[model samples]
Target: MTTPMNNKNSLLVELFVEELPPKALKKLGDAFANEIFGTLRKLDYLEAASAKTTFASPRRLGVHITHVREVCPDIAVRTRLLPLQVAFGPDGEPSPSLLKRLEKEGATLAQTTRAFEQDKEFVFLEKVAAGRSLRDGLEAALHVAIENLPIPKVMSYQLESGCELPGWSSVSFVRPAHGLVALHGDTVVPIEALGLQAGRETHGHRFEAAVDPVVLRDANSYALQLQDEGAVIASFEARRAEIARQLAAAAVKVGGGSVPIHDDALLDEVTALVERPNVLVCSFEREFLEVPQECLILTMKANQKYFPLLDAQARLTNKFLVVSNISPDDASAVIEGNERVVRPRLADAKFFFDQDRRKSLASRVESLGKVVYHNKLGTQGERVQRVMHIARGIAEKLGDAKVAAQATQAAQLAKADLVTDMVGEFPELQGTMGRYYALHDGLDAAVADAIEDHYKPRFAGDELPRNNVGLVVALADKLETLVGMFGIGNLPTGDRDPFALRRHALGVIRMLIEKDLALGLDALLQDAAAQFSAIAGFDSSKATVELRDFILDRLAGSLREQGASAQEVDAVLAPFPQRLGEVPKLLAAVRAFAALPAAAALAAANKRIGNILKKAPEADAHVSELLLKEPAEKALHAAMAEVVPAANAQFDAGDYTASLQTLAALREPVDAFFDGVMVNAEQADLRLNRLGLLMSLHAAMNRVAQLERLAV
Candidate 1:
């Protein structure tokens, strides 16, 4: 039965199908609901305050919308024709053009009028067009919504025999659709999609549903009916919250300050895998806890979708929480089944750990030679050799023999774990497992930590390496990758960064700035580029220049993200400061200098001086006192004599803010000189002398930053 025509009411639409991919469920749900709402609103089939609610589960995707209209109101539409003069003759009678247009529009001369548009008069036809009906609008909206869904993959399946149209043998969708429901109030608004007919029937939990094919009562009662009879929590967010509450309560029941390990992605996946969540406490053998907690936690979370509990000190405990879809009075059978299933998985991890320890990391180094790093480059062994040399070069720049040796050792052993049994089983454990093996080999604590810390800052906001040796190796590793990739002309374009060069550049910047390392940016690039000379196609000279520009651009963006204004960043980075550690101080000085009352005048005068110096390209910073005949030029020279030395001393002392502030004293003389002196004098020496005077003042004023960039 259908609702009465032209009535406004809340509407509901649902698609019941096979289980969806848990990782992509949320995205699919959002895309479906938003596309439907947008299409309805575009067609003027919604009330002003119409709102939508989304529901998704393992076997269903649905949306409930309020204040939908059965029929949209009529609106006025205009159709343009030929120009006024062309449409009518000199006698004011309709011409052939007007006749043809009127015939096509089904209009008469009385229905046509002259309107002004685009600075010209045109003949236009005005008509009232009836709005679309709900059935027509909704059918179109459904097709659009389904077509635009962000399905990770699609599958084709044959419709049921004798159920659909005779020729409709197959259909394609993210999953096979079994039923669809389109409700307007208590009445079903008939629609068809994916070889399924619209109805109020939707199935719930496979085993716990109180009724088969639960029938919804109305558009507003779908969620309640599903929960009361179907034993399903239909809304994704509500179900996730419920699971969280149950997980927390289950932890409390276990005592010993145990809490389920927190991973939002795992929580989301668990929420999508169950229609009705039942958090059950399960346990495994305690001997497996001897393995690294990361390995165990990863195995459980990634493979079993189980939450391993952590004690008060955040150590993994044997007790874990599992979110099951069914809740029987006797949960012991289910608990035991899960426990028995996880035992072998844990044993595999234990076996791998025990076997991997038999051979020291140094012995595994030879195996890396057989594993290819990049075809254009060389094997993993060759890459490791490059990284060791680069690390040594960087450490030597710091002038510490002990740190240099430590960095080389760490770099040499970093990639050896790539061939280990544990790392081969779980690639994410490559660096982590290396640290364990290094320690077991009786290596230094610093070297062991560096093996793991070299991959620190794997993502944004991640921590940096812990020790100086780690820092040196991390920088060297990132630099080697960056220089090698850029040399091959393999660069990131738009959103596609297969090489992750941008990340490597940012990592280098963060370490240099955060650690305040006294390293020159150009020299680092040069040294890195120097290691790639053996490769045939590698262009060291060109890649080094391009890579430098790339890194500086990234630094400018980073500084802006950290709250520095664009202009301030430009001023500080303009000179391309070699010691990147001093960038923060330079920016601070620029900001401080910008706040002074004399700052505006000084910046403006500096800009004017730059323009004048550009005209006299041969001007040097040597001002002859004898040629300083004008009072303004002499006063400026005298002021610089007193202030330049003091500013230079402050700049040399690394007191950047004080250095810029000291230059503030020259603003008056600078402004007076620009206003009173004619820099382009007729005599050659006079003009050259004046230009040299301005050049000296410009040099002194811009010691901390390019002050002209602060000009408004």
Candidate 2:
């Protein structure tokens, strides 16, 4: 017998699209990658190493895979057939008369073999399926994956001259599939399905050479050749590194140690927009620096996809760097072209800034009513009123009346920028524009900062509210969103979170936990739910619970992301309506208790306690001191008496670990009582008494968590 050796190797795949929008490019790449993984898994290709790398410029969307397995594993296929009795007459064998009739009619076998499953008792046939060559499998898989790749929009193109005018019109792709290069090892696999012939050829820059094709020996050689031939670097990290290096050098030349590269999104867009990126330094009028630095940077980044340079003082400099995909013979022309494009954008930004500065923040209040928030939610003005009320409630909870009042004022004016011409043109400038406009309009710095920071931590890993007023507004804003949508029964279903209520709830949870504010969610949700009463067809009570559960789910997910186990998350969350921030403290306690040597034993004891109490008829009975017969039961009772106060103290102090430690002291006595005594004794009163003692034990542990749900 020969043993088979496992082949552990990577797979490489690349998709060449005509062009893709940068915003949609990442998602498309991710989807394709996910689909490939899912499809391969379904096909029983578990050992195949795969990764999808996507690259997009104006002309092409390229995806490269690495570490893909050569072939799916060999599988034992089986087919089941109908039992012999069903195929023949009931004479204990095939009947001669029936056989003669079947022979005359040319009847075939009554049953045939199908695929294998464990549920079948018998199989008629079984075969060992040999794995195909990596090249063959990859070709087949790639053809299917490419044709099925979901693109929001698709285009078609004409094909080479063939009899009957080659069916390009019948083909569809995200963009017209201009060309495809499918290489297996060193050989090109002909793709006959898509009307493409596999060739050891690929093109460089479209303008650099009209049709220069290179043969690739493998993936590594192919990547190198593509870069050497004026093709843009296909790797995202490589392009980012090149951009960073060029930006650094430009900063040094401008006598600044570094420049502020503010927009990560713009950087990603620029990186995707180019194949061969060349960094160029361009100077603008120094007077432009007088404009708010944010406005200038936003204009440059949003319009031109340029990186702004700053001096050592961290102030904006007159210099900016632009990344150009094409290498220019006269670089000055490119610089001149970029400067011309940036001028009008900067002029418009300055005009908006100047115009916005003239209006007072207080005066902008009336304008907020003109901006619609949501169709059913009335205007921004109404939402602000809700937020103001919520903020005041939050402030009262925080014991900060002054900041609460400040938050109220801030919330009322927060949406004022929505009515501004500047924010209307630049939607991204909503909170930011408010802050800038507020500062210019001579509002208090705290109020202006609150207006801006209320939208903090907008995405994962983003910063949360820094100021008290900001925190109040953030809570109020999120609460209103959750309450309003949930009241109307427009809850998020699976991936369809149209209102972004999940994000809002998650943000609220993060803000509260991060700020360590001990405000109760129940009261807050109740207040928020109350506001929607006047609205038609609202269910306030159900909405309140749904909103809390939503926040709690996010909290659990966030904790799990921080390396907490699912069991631990459930154990911590088992107690409903607890302080949201205290969840981590509770989990830490549970984990600490779990770590102790006696923790498992204590958990076992608690489990037994719960089980006994569940079977008992009534839990109202108390064990009398006179009824205690066994020394173990007496010892357990004494231990519970001593541990209860200490456990309660630890729980109150938020020292869950200490509480669990205190509870663990009862484990030995609990074990002894269970081992020595029968919980369901013949004497009804005695059994009832034993059950009551166990109920008492449960009561002490339930102060922290329901132990039954935490079962191992």
- TM-score of each model, paired residue for residue: 0.95, 0.82
Q: Estimate the lDDT of model 2.
A: 0.72
Please state the error at residue 627 of candidate 1 in Å.
1.1
lDDT of 1 at 550: 95
Off by over 4 Å in 2: 1-17, 24-139, 148-150, 160-169, 182-189, 210-237, 260-264, 611-618, 621-635, 672-695
The residue-level lDDT of candidate 1 at 589 comes to 94
Q: What is candidate 1's lDDT per residue for 515-542, written digit by digit as tens?
A: 9999999999999888889998998865
For model 1 the local lDDT of residue 314 reads 100
What residue pairs clash in candidate 1, if any at all?
Answer: none
TM-score of 1: 0.95
> Worst ten-residue run, lDDT, model 1?
1-10
Best-performing candidate as measured by lDDT = 1
- In model 1, the Cα lDDT at residue 594 comes to 91
